[model samples]
Target: MSENLNPAELQKTCLYDRHVALQAKMSPFAGFMMPIQYDSITVEHNAVRQKVGMFDVSHMGEVFVEGPEAEKFVNWIFTNEIRGFEPGKVLYGMMCYPDGGVVDDLLVYREFAPDHFLLVVNAANIDKDFAWIEEHAKGFDCTVRNESPVWGQIAVQGPESEKVLADVLGLPEAANLGFYTFYDTEYKGKRMIVSRTGYTGEDGFELYTSIDGTVELWDRLIAAGVQPCGLGCRDTLRFEAGLPLYGDELSAEISPVMAGLGMFCKFDKDFIGKEALLAQKGGEIARKLVGIEIEDKAIPRAGYPVELEDGTEVGIVTTGYHSISLDKSICFALVDKAYAALDTPLSIRIRKKVFPGKVVKKRFYQTNYKK
Candidate 1:
């Protein structure tokens, strides 16, 4: 998808110059000229796993919904329940189409009031997600605003993330943040939103600040010896932790149930895709997402064919890699439900060779979330 973008038309984040100064390999991603790697993917990957790393995540989109019907409107559109959401709490879920296909997976944050909420969505689906929300809000007494451009985001992820933010950035309030929670604080007298949330399966925080504040924070972290990470390691880390990337694991044609994300879908509420998802849950689902451990060193990639011993095609790989942390070739594949069970024998076609593999737990490594 990124290959088709014209470099001249790509957007630049506030940290673009900093990335160039560090000699990061910049590429067009999600309509933006973003860094793919600064040093090596392995080194950056280990930095986050062992110590600390920071990411320029300003490309993510943020939308605000505020009104008397904010909770009701959010519940109607999203697959998760938000009945007990209070300020600072966040819920992860997907907005699905009527046919149960995913619209996008997002994090919904309950802000200062029950009538106000914030949504953090994928960068590539920002425009489309906002439009969908606006169109469905026809009869609700609410206000929907896309606030993507007004904020800049940086993710400080690792075991020492909190300490880095508190000591290096001098944001002492960061140490008090709880998992999946956020707090409004001040940095350099500028309002900032700090959340104990991250994409990597580690203890971390995501800070949202003004464009200028973002630049200052990035500089401060770099000066404090925090490694500047790029998207390459980000993918490997998230894959190792079994976190689903939107376009890879969940898509317009892939429902939450098929992606093994049924826990995030609440059936008691009447959501847009409730009927279809409930039916899928109660009936037979044709395919399901599962983990595959390749016996060989060959890496399996997205769109590779999955088959049984007799070469009968079953499904396709969604995301895969030679895991840096685990030192094994692993992949996430969407395959026939019959082959989704643990220990199921399977084969992945890589180039002209078919490599033997077995279905295992999707998570290659245990997450270290501070919950």
Candidate 2:
């Protein structure tokens, strides 16, 4: 606990003190001091998928938008339809540039109050997203504020997460919260927001509470036997679950259509990139993101060359990992759309040898997302 209290001018989260108290390995992440892990990455990753684990994800960005013009402004920026979201529900969507490239993937929280909502975004894209929103909000009457510093977020994930959280937090029906939904609850007389959402494809809840509450909640969850996980485990878990990391699979250069996220785009509603998307719709995507399973013992890695059966270069791997669940080397690659189909055979250039790989389903492991 005492190891991280020195004066380094690094930003700290509400759970920073608690992490230090638990003797976590702290490191810089997205400009904030964060815990990388309490134990080994592989151990924590397995814990979350098989048993129970919790992570301090307060480093994520939070922005609140509310006003009479809120709906209109949000509709203008995001690629999904919000007309169907009821209060206490959240929607997964993306904010994009006019050219149909993603600015950031976000979860929009529909508050109980009409015209009020919260946008949870990626930490690294905070400044850029804020600027983009503000620039596009010139004539709109809504106000946007970056609230990342005011709150701390925690994710309790795994198959056992529901039972453990309910037992520890004394919130019955907490486990019953519908997937992709949120609930405003009172815990220890303090207001808390718990959402059934997470980056790891496992069933989990992302809890938002005050800084003081965050410390207490963390302690309680730990006492309830929840394993403390870190960014490394978080990444591996999401990767194994076939989830995409922002910079790895999605970037300004990759459009949602090319990334197989076209379902999130609401063509019925006009968004910033609607014109570009429409223009490119039905046209062949030059390169597409797909998953590949390596056959040889050699592991495929990011930036490794991908080639066709004839040995012609196609693309490169963007994210790769040795899946503990599948017990095989798996990778995500942006390959020529012609080879994006399932079961397509390809090879990865590893060192001087070519390792055979096949384009399988993008999701390497089955997810436990609630119905």
Candidate 3:
């Protein structure tokens, strides 16, 4: 917390003051002054794994789509099938360019109203994503609104999340809802949403409400001794859970098909990137994402070259770590498709030495999502 950080003009979330008051390790992330850790990354990570932890994800962006053509418009831009999705249900997918590059990966919440939907996007891509959305919406008979400035969101995650949310917050309805579903209700005379979607691969709930309500909830949760997590632990938890970060795993150069997320992209219907993705699937794609487990304790970092047994460079590591939960060096890498098969011998170049490893399942840790 004492290191001199770069003085870049950054945006602040609704809980910025709370993090500062706690003396959290604040860093610039996604153009916002976000908390990297409160006490320790490992402590906060473990709290979310064994008990319950909370993250002030108020910096995430929110967009509202409403009109007679809302459903049609969303389905056109999104990769997933939202044609007949029921209200209160949420779908995770990507918005793509005509050439199949990802604009952003987001969660779309179907509202109870027949002609309305809400999109929760990444914090860093807020401006870019909204502009893309607005551009594509020119011909549609719908209205798009970037409501990120007014909304606040918090993710309460772990095995004990339900109990904490129900007992501490008195939101019993949260317990009644199932995974990937949400319910809208009034809190302190203001509208709010409670959704079950865990980015950490744990049973969790993300509460979206007014900024004041978010602050009050944070205060109460802290008073009740729930560990306040930050982006550092959030990254580790999500990585262990086998979730993909947008810029790292899926980017302008990486498509959902290339990242092994083709399951989320529906091909039966037409979308903005349908033809390009279809062509990519039908053609011989050069690179694909795979998991590599190194035998040594050497931690692999991003941009480190992945090599063949003969010292030929095949690809590079996208994300890697000495996994806290698994206690091994592992990473996600984009490699030549010819070498992506299970049990293929591979090596990662760490600084000056090449460490041998093998292709393994990307999901290094088993998740506990309560039914």
Candidate 4:
């Protein structure tokens, strides 16, 4: 689903000029003028898969949580268990409605400071997620601040990302960051964070700094020959790795459990959506997300219908592509639980023709993420 945008009132990120100078294909995305691609999508996609690439993700939203009740409050609202979480650790989880529908999937970083956290959320759901967090925090003694406008972020992704961050950016501390860990430092006296995290399945890091620092860092990476990537490849890479996009695989109506992401949701801990999720667990799951591999060369796309052999529709494609890395047509579809089993035969109605397919593992490509 696309973000609501007037097109006439698109916003710009901190590195808008840099993208323009690079002659990127700019388009309105999530209320911002984002780069769809600097080079060909294939080239950029491969750059990240093989070597390194960077994205201007300054449009992503960041929210700060602080107070005496921050731990308890975050734990209550989040599906992941982070009670008495250690500083520098990052956890991926979703905030779910009481009915078990997802509010938003986000990365929550327990800051080094006591009772503080940083939540990095999707751009389209920034305001909505912040409001949801505030509304659920009525009785809690924590303060929530939307720091989206203050931070500039970039993701350095790929196999060589550690060397790039060390040699190019000269942040050797980043090389020592374990997966899902972060360390705070100063960049030109502004608070900068280097987190060993990324949307792409490859081991990488997302650096958050001030707007000016972001621009400077972007220039540095560009000058050092790091491929300036765009959202086009970002989507392909994440899709290849079977990561969920908020409005797609996971949404307000698609619970994490239905998306086969129950592992990230902690049931032992009291959470906003735990009871409903447990109820869903006890009952029949009507639908579930699954992967489909088409036999034909025709690509599957979002909104395409999935059907049984007789053309009886069961579900819709959430995201699909002719995978650049795997050289196969793969897609994630939310379908009836009866047909969600691996190897269950299915078909995708691409346009006029229905192509034969079968359910497979959602992870179409094996990831090379470093531990």
lDDT of all predictions: 0.93, 0.85, 0.92, 0.93
lDDT, candidate 3, 291-336, per-residue tens: 9999999988989999999999999999999998889999999999
Clashing pairs counted in every model: 0, 2, 0, 0
Clashing pairs in 4: none
Considering summed lDDT, which 10 consecutive residues are worst modelled in model 3? 1-10
The count of backbone overlaps in candidate 2 is 2
Per-candidate TM vs. native?
0.98, 0.94, 0.97, 0.98
Off by over 4 Å in 3: 1-8
- Give lDDT: candidate 4, residue 202: 95
**Alpha-carbon RMSD to native, per candidate:** 1.1, 3.4, 2.3, 1.0
Candidate 2 per-residue C-alpha lDDT over 1-371 given as tens digits, one digit per residue, 9 for 90 to 100: 02334447567888888889888898876667888888888899899889889999887888999899998899889988998778998998889888888899898999998999899998878888889888887898989888887777889998888888778887667777989998898756677899999988799899897777777888889887789999888988888887777887887888888888888889999889888766656774688999999887687888999998788999999888788777888899999888889989999999899988899988888999877
Cα deviation of 163 in candidate 2 (Å)?
1.0
* Model 4 quality (TM-score): 0.98
Q: In model 3, which residue pairs have backbone atoms overlapping below 3 Å?
A: none
Relative to the true structure, candidate 3 has a C-alpha RMSD (angstroms) of 2.3
